[model samples]
Target: MTPPHPLAPAAPPVVPHVEVPTPRVPPPSSLSLPTPRRRGRGDDALPRPQSVVPGALAALAVSGACLALTLTAPAAPALLVAIVLGVVARAAHAVPASFERGLAWVGRRVLRTGVVLLGLQLSARDVLALGPPELGVLVVTVATTFSATLWLGRRLRVGRSLTLLVATGFSICGAAAVAAMSPVADAEDDDVATAVALVTLYGSVAILVVPVVARAARLSDRTAGLWAGMSVHEVAQVVAAAGAVSAAALSVAVVAKLARVVLLAPLVTAVGVVRRRGGARSGGAAVPVVPLFVIGFLVAVAVRTVGGVPDVAVPVVHGATTLALGAAMVGLGTQVHVARLARSGGRAVLLGAVATTVAMTVSLGGLLAVGALG
Candidate 1:
């Protein structure tokens, strides 16, 4: 009907569909997947060099400081300084874990190395020179004092391990005696540490006080030396106490103390045997074996007597060993907190004081009775 409108009538022709390309998505990259780096045998084999250097430097510093103080304070006693340093280290937690681990390693593995070095300082012949009478006196005094201390420790409620350590240390040698008995007694680190501190403290006091008392009493050098060696808790203390009396006294005291140290193994073994029997009945692990360091110390003394070590090397090695021990002592001291010492330790200290007094009285009386002072 409207055929009239040619332009409108024509209408638009239908358009054909055309295909268009869609954006391509790239496949996930290999790097994008999580991959754990494998550790080669070689990679894990070596210790990180950087981590060890600091610990080495710290140990060296501690050792150097200890030596410097010893040199500078010849009159004041170096052990005191070492103890103080150890306490400080403990308080500040300044010692690195690596250094602590190293010290422990040395203490357990290379302890004999220290003992061997210490041997250059003594001889069996020197020990034997004291003769049977003096030896008898020394032996009886050590045994009696040790037994009395242990008895008192039990009565006083001191821990069993601590009591053993204190008794052995007091009766036989000082630090060496404690070290020998520590494992056998199943002493914790803290127990050994506390015992060491007590020994060190009292030893220092004896070193300073005994000579003054001896001088005032007008005792002979040999008498004073015997008294100091028998009463003091440490070899260093005996030496220091006797030296304050006189050089002659120092010589006597050191020899006497060394002789006492030689008795450590038998004494500890006896204690261990007793402990093992008791533990067996109680259904506990057997007592630990006596430490080899004590044997090493005895061997070193024998070797020195037999002329095994060189003279110059002796002093050098001795100095190094002493420094290491001092450092370790400092570490031990630092582990104790004053608060803890005050809280749980007061009773132990009291027990130690009583034991020390008993030891001193018994020793002095025995010495006088035997005419050892003359």
Candidate 2:
């Protein structure tokens, strides 16, 4: 009995209740911390030092190549080199976005400078020399070509952007015309690029080939100039083509080309107004201001004519323009891809040929009908 009592007592003493505490977790808000920020789409992350030097060197190399090509082939179309280079650059796909951004910046700057420099080469008297009859012919030619390009672009099922670019270049002063209209149309970089390429290629060919054709057709110097100015897609091309004929032809071509340039402001304004009025998909909103460069161009021309910029300054400006343009061409070439051009081979070539033929025919006909070319 004593032993049982001792064991029972021992069991009862171990029977005390023990309480276990539950662990608590912090609240969701308390546990949560600020997430590390990610770089945004527009962020300009610093490039590695190693990458920077090579990229700069590449850009310089490309620019040097363009300069060499241009110097070697002064009479040949410089625009062609630009186009080829652009195609190659685009195909490479290894080029940095920063390089492209730089190229675009240079292109715009050079374009503005080129426009201003062009004014030094002009005189108010030159514009007035166009006269009423010649003015009428120019107006008619521009209007007709513009309309025809639009209609044909639609008929051919070309993209809206391409159509606008082509029409502006064809109807106005070629590359300058397209460049001016790009912002109004809200054209993409590729659109601007493609248009430049086509215009450059065709314009170059026209400058070299058209003079021969004009001669074969028994067209006079004035006629050749008019045809080249009206049909060619760039001022430089017009000058080149005209120069191939005679000095008088060069004067006529430049004058005709300027007459086309004068139409740029009105055309851009009209397009802006039409876009605002819901003409053709509204094209987003109107830009706050038209391109300032266009105004600068006109102003420079006026100043040159009125202020009488020194004759020596004219050559210097022209040389600067050439260098800047060469730089832009190099930039453009670096963005081009030979592969894309090859893929677009037959179709693009065919389209370009057709467009050129159409432009030539219309320009020649208009010139002949108006007796502007003899």
Highest lDDT: give the candidate number.
Answer: 1
Off by over 4 Å in 2: 1-68, 93-100, 107-122, 279-285, 332-351, 372-374
* lDDT (10s digit) by residue, model 1, range 1-374: 55556555676789998898998766655556766544322211223445445543454466568777777876544444665666677677776776654444333333234444565567677778686767777888888888888888888888888888888877876665676776677765567677777787677777777888888888889878988887888776787788888899888888788787777777877877787777632114467455556667667777888888767776676677676666555544545576766675877887778767776777777777778454
User: Once model 2 is optimally superposed onto the true structure by TM-score, how far is the C-alpha of residue 235 displaced, in angstroms?
Assistant: 2.3
- How many steric overlaps are in each model, in order? 3, 16
Query: What is candidate 1's CA lDDT for residue 73?
Result: 71
Local distance difference test values of all predictions, in order = 0.69, 0.66
lDDT of 2 by residue, 139-210 (tens): 777777777777776776666776787777767766667667776677655555666777777887888777
lDDT of 2 at 107: 50
Q: Each model's TM-score, in the order given?
A: 0.77, 0.73
Over the full model, what C-alpha lDDT does candidate 2 score relative to the true structure? 0.66
Instruction: Specify the poorest-scoring 10-residue window by lDDT in model 1.
Output: 38-47
Quote model 2's TM-score: 0.73
